[model samples]
Target: MSALPTTATHEPEAPIISAVKSNASAENRVHGLKLAILLGSLTLVTFLSLLDTSIIGTAIPHITSEFHSLPDVGWYVGAYTLGAATLQPLSGKLYAYFPTKAVFMGFVFFFELGSLICGVAQSSTMLIIGRAVAGMGVSGIFNGAITVLSAAVGNEKSPLYFGIVLGTSQMGIVCGPLIGGALTEHASWRWCFYLNLPAGGLAVLILAFIHFPELAQKKTFSMALVRKVVPELDLIGFLLFVPPSVMFLLALQFGSGNTHAWNSATVVGLLVGSGVLAVIFILWERRMGDRAMLPGSLVKQRMVWVSCTYGMCNGCCMMIASNWMPTFFQAVKGEGPTLSGVHILPSILSQLSAVIVSGALISKLGYYLPWALGGGIIMAIGNGLVSTFTATTSVGQWIGYQIVVGAGRGAGLQAPLVAVQNAVKPSQVPIATAFLVFLQNFGVSIGIVLSNVAFTQTLTQAIPLYAPSVSSQAALDAGAGAGAVRDLVRGHEDELSGVLRAYSEGLRNIFYFLVGMSCIAVVLSLGMGWVDVRKKKDSTKSTGDNEAQEKKVEEKSLNEA
Candidate 1:
């Protein structure tokens, strides 16, 4: 609300201060070098974490084949996500207590160790454990990157730096599937996990040498401060929050198809239990005051709630498209993982380009709402176009559809983060940002699970109708087996073509659902109020006041002479 006192004013006697006394003479040469190094290190971490999500998706079939447990494949991805989502809020408190650099380094180490375990894993169980471990590190890495960026640049330059970090991160998401596909096709799927080893190691090295002034140990560890803030960590809130959240996700992912039926006690119980726990967590948070894990004020902020909702919707659409589109390519287009990844390239590239462009524009214009709304609308349109795809759709048409979806995602992804960062106070930035990430993650998990359910159900119903001679039981068996359905259909080209058409139809249905979801996102984006980057306003006013005061000082000196 008010301008933060400039460092020049805070430390008037510092020798370098004189250089910054006037606008033309101002120099941040040393600070600029430090910022570049820190940003570079953080960018790598951001890229790798996002890259893992898509890269692994492209490698899922390979992992399933090696483990010979197709049913358990979801856990490999789910475990990592669950771990990351669970630890996100905690990372905020950890930053408050520990030296940020040390914590960041420690987390990267954990991430590398997890990558090593995953690369060497001989069984699904081992891989799941590895994923869980990697997720813990990932949770810290992403949150840490954002926290460090804000602290290093301060509020005035934060949006620009945040945009850069996010934009760079999108590159990892774009490249991940292609990289994973190439490795899976030519070498081994194991390389997907192994790739992170070198990348993570490089990031660790960069961070070790890069001086982040924000993370420097300012005061000796204070037991009193720790004691004061410990209650705010909301251990009980987490206890209520995590188990139910995980259970709800599990119910969504595993309770469909062969794992459990919608009517079954296992599915019904987990879903109901999760709901009750969520309600309890909210109540507990309300009772805890500042100690609440999610403060009540967070919900009251219209911008925060709207931005979060918009993020959740966009996240849902993005995940659904990313996860299922590859499968569609394999099923309908008869493409391998490598080709499927390549086909999706347009979407990934567009997303990356859009993010960078949006970041620059936001920095220059100092507004985010219009971009947010435009992004949502474009995403809706793109998703709607994708819903029209049929088994016989041309490759060019497919590529076009992908490009549209990518553009929409790219435009929208960074807006919510900008909105939240702009709306909250500096101290609340980490928690607020974490909350946005949490909702996005939760939305992604939900989207994948929901889309999978819809796809499975549609395939089940259509397979029998489209290929009557195949028999319902046989179709079910084929659907359950890894690659067996494709192999079977490959042998009976004519009949299988019909079944593939049905699968494509089912996919189109799921895309339609995504389109509707994205439309809702667009509506939510429209509700994000107006862009109001707090520091920008204060900086402009302060600059004007300073200029006017300087003129008065110069006039008085002249009159005295």
Candidate 2:
């Protein structure tokens, strides 16, 4: 027998996505222009936030130049990603407990504030701080976008609408480097951040006008309400989660080339502390039971953990590759930032195309497992091909290889998400999504750090071997930016080719890691039980249906218990 559950098992009694169909009549639904405006605003915000993540990759070289601080580049990216990962799951509970519109708008305000801070940052430390704040907002926005979108359109059409949101948002990510390159070259690196201020403000303004149905709450604020809300947010779990994540990322950032040696006291202490914190967090969550950030019952499910692992590996493979390609083009081929961004269009376009096509196929065939498996296999092959790139690799080869990688990533990017939605009970869907998103972002943080470690370690070793006159420490001091790489080797014409070759080899080394990660993703994906999303049925009265589903789930839970 297949591992896939043919019927509902023990799940939650109440759905996280409100059964608005039963609560609100058809006549009261937002449609036409109002609906368009709401969705458009949400989609725009999503695009801008995701765009910020990739846009900085191209701008980093310029930013490093302005501040003359090459050592902080990893922190710049990792700070935002870490912040987002930390807050992602918590945001789900916030939405569940508060007025949806208000909570979402509040996050937008903070996101914009962070963007403004980044736009005017005068130092690298200030910029890193700004990125962290902005990431906090992004985490909430991501969770809210899907939650509100589902509630706005109802369950029947959410899949299609979600596809649109994801496609549009990813378009921002694809176009980020292009826009960042243009702004950084023609204007200033600061403009890359300044652009978000106006755009984010506009999104906030539009969101302010739209009123989403509010969950019932206390009419007046009181200590009692605060007491009730604090525990629901799982503040203790939040505290426990932070130390390990912070320690782990700090160890990665500081251990290799950034500041400290791997065996240095700081690095060793952080790694050991992180391990201890992780154990404590797991034990804490187990004690918290259902109130935990990672609820024990839901997390123990085979499908949930499998999907989460796939998401983590998928994140590691795709993000590490996408963020580093511009540097590859700039360093190896000596392409200008704008042209390098343009060259990456093949990967971006293919990824976008695959996502849309795969989404439609999932909707039509109702099966995501085949696409997930195929995507993982294709991605592994793509990354493997990319790992063969050399200093003199032909343009056609690079482009073709990237296309394969992009297509593969796009095909499976959202497959795990789709599987989670289908496998979990309606009530558990939101948390499950949040958990996956957290894992994905957390994976992204680790991937970028891992890439940094590999790049710095390999480049440090290869530089001196290939170009004996140039000190490896000097190149290490140049930081992870392409511009810095060129500047460090500028006067030594005889050593330039050797240095470029070293950079190329170092990059290829990172791809080798990505290839392995992609393969691991494929293995994890195999455990996602087969379920046909297309053949799924939606009952007219979800509230009544929910009750029946609950009874079935209860029996299963009891039997297992």
Q: What is candidate 2's TM-score against the reference?
A: 0.89
Show model 2 residue runs off by greater than 4 Å. 1-23, 68-71, 215-222, 480-483, 538-561
Candidate 1 lDDT for residue 488:
50
Q: What C-alpha lDDT do the candidate models reach, one value each?
A: 0.74, 0.80
Tell me the tens digit of each residue's lDDT in model 2 across 172-226. 8888989988887789878888998888888888788887743333124467645
Give per-model CA RMSD.
7.1, 7.0
Ten-residue segment with the worst summed lDDT in candidate 2?
4-13
Report the error of model 2 at residue 108, Å: 0.9
Off by over 4 Å in 1: 1-40, 64-78, 122-126, 146-166, 205-212, 215-229, 363-366, 468-485, 532-540, 543-561
lDDT of 1 at 190: 88
